[model samples]
Target chain A: MSSTRKSQVQSSKVASEQIKTQKDIDMESDEDRNDENRNDNQQQSRPKLSIQRQDGDNTNATYSFLNEDHTLGNLLRNVIIKNNQVEFCAYSVPHPSEPIMNVRLQVAPSCGDTKKVLKHGLKRIAKMSDVLTEKFQNALDKYENRMSD
Target chain B: MYGMEQINTATGFANAKFGSSKGQGAKGFDEPEIRILELSKYVIKFELLNTDLSVANSLRRIIIAEVPTMAIDLVEVKENTSALHDEFIAHRLGLIPLQSFNVDQFNLSDQCACSSMCAQCSVQFKLHAVCSDRDQMEVNTRHIQPLSDAPIIPVQYVNDKGIEEDPILIMKLSKNQQLDMNLVARKGNGKIHAKWSPVATCQMRKEPIVEIDQDKINRDLDIEKRKEFVALCPREVFAFNDYRNAVEIENSDKCIQCIECLRFAQANNLERAVKIAEREDKFVFTVESTGVLTPEDIVSRALQILMRKLYELGTQMKKYGVNAD
Candidate 1:
């Protein structure tokens, strides 16, 4: 029983050492994190968000969706362009393996909120889809009624 | 307001009438209405509303004649023993449409900055045809090679077989009928010669407004009478659908507003059967291109030229204090 207690103490010491080494490695990686932002005092305060804008100004904006695919991007583009205030909108996937879609939207001068416009367009599309499904169900019911007759 | 007595009948296209009776006339007067109906690779159809007939006619003329094109203007024959004469061959060569684009890059020979002909406004072509065999030989436009590196210059025509089409029969040769020549191509507008015209045909017509009263005709007339009524109008403006048992407007735009249907209705003792009214302010245009530039390009370029002239005139008027606005 005494020997067992000794082995347990040694194992606990090794585990603590591993924890210390892991902390050191993490700190090293933190130091290596982007020399450009290294001097930034607000780095710790910054929120870690996935989406980022590679390029843009007031009238134009280019957004990057890292994990999102092209299908959603294309659909969003098609719907957003329906607003008519969107002068030009296009999307591109850097590489097939990257699985990232970059959407570039240019809002007209008279337009207000680009983000709100995009959300509204998406909502409108969803509503249209719901209406289509409802219509389809009604048509199916009518067909069945006729068949029964 | 041509006394629209039976509007909102829901009878057949009663609701189709646009509420433009008052607004269209007043609003269209200030800004000339130009609506492009159909646009494709090489064809475009549009309607110009509230414009004078003279303006439309002039636009049509400008599309056909004012558009610039490149053509072989001069040819030097070094050797030719072909059956066709040199002048005839040169004339034929001058007419071949060389598929040209980037029109702004080149200028007319006279309009060029150079004192004389230069590469900026003129392209040189050289052709050499020699037949040593006893068999017959054919020579077409393909043989005429552009000396410059310009890709659009010789206007290559490819056939379905994926082979370069007939070089174009410049002249047929029998054994020793060899032809060698140097040709010069220059930029020219169709105003000088129709060979440079970009448009094949540009036509405009007043827009036709078709009205149908199905309530009166369908309820009162028998099947045979209805069929007769459908067939009475020319241009096949209406068709009877067997499945729906309805007389529908197959192609309403073709209606010429001849009032023949109204006359037939009167003869058959029927009232308010069919009515067609031609909008005096609205017009429909049909444009087809000959080659090179597409119909859209031709129409847009014509409009651009027309607008430039207007802008220049306005500026000039401003100088003279004529109150051009």
Candidate 2:
């Protein structure tokens, strides 16, 4: 009974045709379901990083980092801008609600690759974090010792 | 920032780096240092010197968002005849902070191999409360008991005199009202939910640089003007010096950059007499923990988490074939 009702609904939708082919209707519904599934997948799984390079320029590029905010964006841009090879570096979150950080980098031709610059900046930031951790630990220890005394 | 070259050339691609000698570089670019100003069990105050604002902000953000702790995430209600709804009780249970020093022993529920929850991934707690004879009864976290013998427990606050304070109240039960439930505590970070955040308040502020020209104030302004200028600062940053008959900075750190004194100085046509600026390289940080972890532990863990994130990004970039030539 439900199938007959569905068919009746389908037929009324396609009333312009005298007799709409059942196979065509089934194929159209299947395609719509597949499109919905594809959209669901896209919404569920966003890639970690997406890179877009200028048409003829390897030195200028924009990188979009998924699940990132000002924490990574500001640090990476600061480190990248400090590098002599970098001509310009800036980052923006694009939208506060979305967890997307876009960083634009333009480097000197001598540097040659923007990805390498980004990787180098990451290493530097990591090293800086290492230093911060060590210093903080030392300070904590000193404070504890003083309190104990 | 100007001494960036010194650090860049320190371990040279080509040898002979700049600022190889000690004590002769830009303020922040020379070295980063930390000084613990105050430390308690739950609160810590520190100064991060010679660091960029971006670096300080990154630390602040990581401490707030990435530090992991154990919190009750899922609750199963067996019988709840209380006036409150099940979801309201479940949400209150989730917000309670558990002692998570041993959080490293458990895996995140999603990362664990368990079908739903297991001993290695989650801690089970049972709460049973009933008001039989009393007109009113209070239900608190103390009534919630752990199913197994794990170190994880609800935070127990202590007063300065080392006395255990009253437990956190969850609800009040009327006559014959009973509540029975099972709670599952899992390891997570603030990014997932604020209940898992280890810190109550993690904040950083720029070091205020307040300058008052005593000589100019003494020469140009009279006692009335000096009193008015001192009263202009809402934070009491300026005090009138009766001896020198000048307006002087009493407590510069109290200045919140209100610019009241600066406006008054400008109105008096005293150029550069009162200046207020912030040290770009210095930041004062205060961290208050939610009893799941100590403030010091939170700071160290945040730095470690940040390092891990950077390392993961680098590896991920390499996996995508972004390696150097």
Best by DockQ: 2
Backbone clash tally for model 1?
3
TM-scores of the candidates in the order shown: 0.56, 0.83
- Residue range A1-149, candidate 1, lDDT tens digits: 11211111111222245456556667766555454255444544432212233344445666555444443466556545544466666778888665467777767667744554544544543333333234334443554466579
User: What's the TM for model 2?
Assistant: 0.83
Q: On residues B122-170, what C-alpha lDDT tens digit does candidate 2 reach at each position? A: 8989998989999999999999999999899999987778889999999
Q: Which residue runs of candidate 2 sit more than 4 Å off their true CA positions?
A: A1-47, A54-57, A94-99, B1-29, B242-245, B320-325
Deviation in Å, model 2, residue B73 alpha carbon = 0.9
Residue clash pairs of candidate 1: B140-B167, B140-B168, B141-B167
For model 1, give the TM-score of chain B: 0.77
Interface RMSD, candidates in the order listed? 33.8, 13.3
Residue A71 lDDT in candidate 1: 38
Candidate No. with top TM-score: 2
What ranges in model 1 sit over 4 Å off? A1-149, B1-29, B32-36, B49-55, B113-116, B157-171, B232-234, B243-246, B256-263, B318-325
lDDT of 2 at B31: 63
Question: What is the per-residue lDDT of model 1 for residues B161-270, given as tens digits with 9 covering 90 to 100?
Answer: 66766555666788876888787777777766667777677788887888788777777778787788789888788888787666778888888777778887888777
Clashing pairs in 2: none
